[model samples]
Structure formats: structure tokens, C-alpha cells
Target: MHGYTQDKDEYAARLRRIEGQVRGLAKMIDNDQYCIDVLTQISATTKALQSVALGLMDDHLKHCVSEALTEGGDTADEKVREASEAIARLVRS
Candidate 1:
């Protein structure tokens, strides 16, 4: 199972909320809402997604990475590499 399995429901709920926010954003554009208001909402949505990403990264380090490190071999190396790549992507975003 994935590291976030324990909080799967919570993650799902959070994503759903973000989805709603995106829909609202689209509606705002359709209704010709003020530019600043729309940009503010976009910033909020981006930060919400970033928060979830950070949480998942923490969970991954605590569970998956720890387990691999305990095993101490090629698997550990791969997991570390995978995590580093993931972090890099997150940072770039």
C-alpha cells in the first residue's frame, strides 16, 4: 500500500475541495469577475495543492523511505533516488 493510505480519505476530501475551487474559478471567469479577485483565488488554490504535496512527501519519507532504508540495499538507493526526483519536481512546480 501507499504511504498515505492511512489518510486516504482525508486526501480525497482535500482534492475534492480543490476541485470545487477550480470549478468556482472557471465560473468566475465566465461571469467576468475582476482580474485581481481571480488571481487571488488562483493563488489560494495553488497553495492548497502545494500543502497537500508537502503532506504526501512527509508521509512518504516517514513510511516508504524509512522502510527502504531499514532494508539497506539497492532498494534503499532506488527509493532515495525516487524521492529526490519527486522533491525536485515539486520544487520546480
Candidate 2:
């Protein structure tokens, strides 16, 4: 089975929850919640977003990377670099 098929719904649900968390965080700020509390929620949302990114990277490596490597040459290297740089950006964000 394709990697996305195994648990796509679960991943989507998690992302939805993360979206809700973000909205809640915004509401908290509007309501003047404690700074520390707002910061904590922001941190949690960041982690959640990271988790989604990591999962996407993992799937891309498993599928796109493998396919590109099989196709061969400089193209594979370029794709690998692209994926690497994307993950790096995700980490930095």
C-alpha cells in the first residue's frame, strides 16, 4: 500500500486539531491571556506543525526520492538537495 493510504485520515485529523489550536491561541491573545500561557500554546503549535512537516518529508523520501534515484543522474542529486533544503527550512521555521 502507498504510505499515505495507511493513515491519511489520522494525519489530516491531527492537522485539523493543530489548526484549531492555532485559532485558540489567537483567541487567547485577544482575550489577554498570560504571556507565558500564550507562548506555551505557540510552542505546542510549532511542534505540531513540525510533526506534519516531518511526516511529509518522510513520505517524500520514501516515494519521490526513491523514484528519482531510480531514474538516475544529476536530476536525482538535484531532487535530493531540494528535499534536504526543504527539511532544513522546516526545521528552522
Candidate 3:
């Protein structure tokens, strides 16, 4: 099973909230809301997404990475590499 399976409901809830925020943003644009206000909402949306990404990374490290390490060998090595790549991508974002 996936590392996120345990908290899948929480993740889905968060994504749903983010989706609502996006729809609100579209409405703001349609209403010709202030530019800075729209930008602020966009920033909030970005931060929410980043929060989810960080949470997923934490879960992966705690569950998937730990399990892989116990197995050792090629699987462990690949998991480490994948985790490193994920961290790099998160950092870049």
C-alpha cells in the first residue's frame, strides 16, 4: 500500500479546499477584483499546495523509506535515490 494511504482522507480534504480556493480565484477575476487581492489569494493557494507536498514527503520518508531501508539492497538504494530526487524537486519549487 502507498505511504499516504493512512492519511488519504486528510489529503483529499486539503485538495478539495484548494480546489475551492481556485474556484474563488476565478470568481475574483470575473468580478475584476483588486490586483493585489487576487495575487494574495494566489500566494495562499501556492502555500497550501506546498504544505501538502511537504506532508507527503514526510509520510514517504517515515513509512516508505523506512520500510525500504529494512529490506536493503537494490530496493533500498532506489528508494533513497527517489527520495533525494523528490526533495530536490520540492526545494526547487
Question: Which candidate should be chosen as best, given TM-score against the real structure?
Answer: 1
Q: Residue-wise lDDT of candidate 1 within 1-93, one digit each (tens)?
A: 989999999999999999999999999999999999999999999999999999999999999999999998999999999999999999999
**lDDT for model 2, on a 0 to 1 scale?**
0.88
Q: Would you list the rank order by lDDT, best first?
A: 1, 3, 2
| Candidate with best lDDT | 1
What does the lDDT read for residue 84 in candidate 2?
88
Across residues 51-81, which tens digit of lDDT does each residue of candidate 2 receive? Answer: 8878978888887788889998988998799
Misplaced by over 4 Å in model 1 are: none
Name the lDDT of candidate 3.
Answer: 0.98
Per-residue lDDT over 30-81 for candidate 3, one digit per residue giving the tens place of the 0 to 100 score: 9999999999999999999999999999999999999999999999999999
Write out the backbone clash pairs for model 3: none
Better of 2 and 3 by TM-score: 3
- Which parts of model 2 have CA positions greater than 4 angstroms off? 1-6
For model 2, the run of ten residues with the poorest summed lDDT: 1-10
TM-score of each model, in listed order: 0.98, 0.85, 0.96
lDDT of 3 at 2: 86
Candidate 1: minimum summed lDDT over ten consecutive residues — where?
1-10
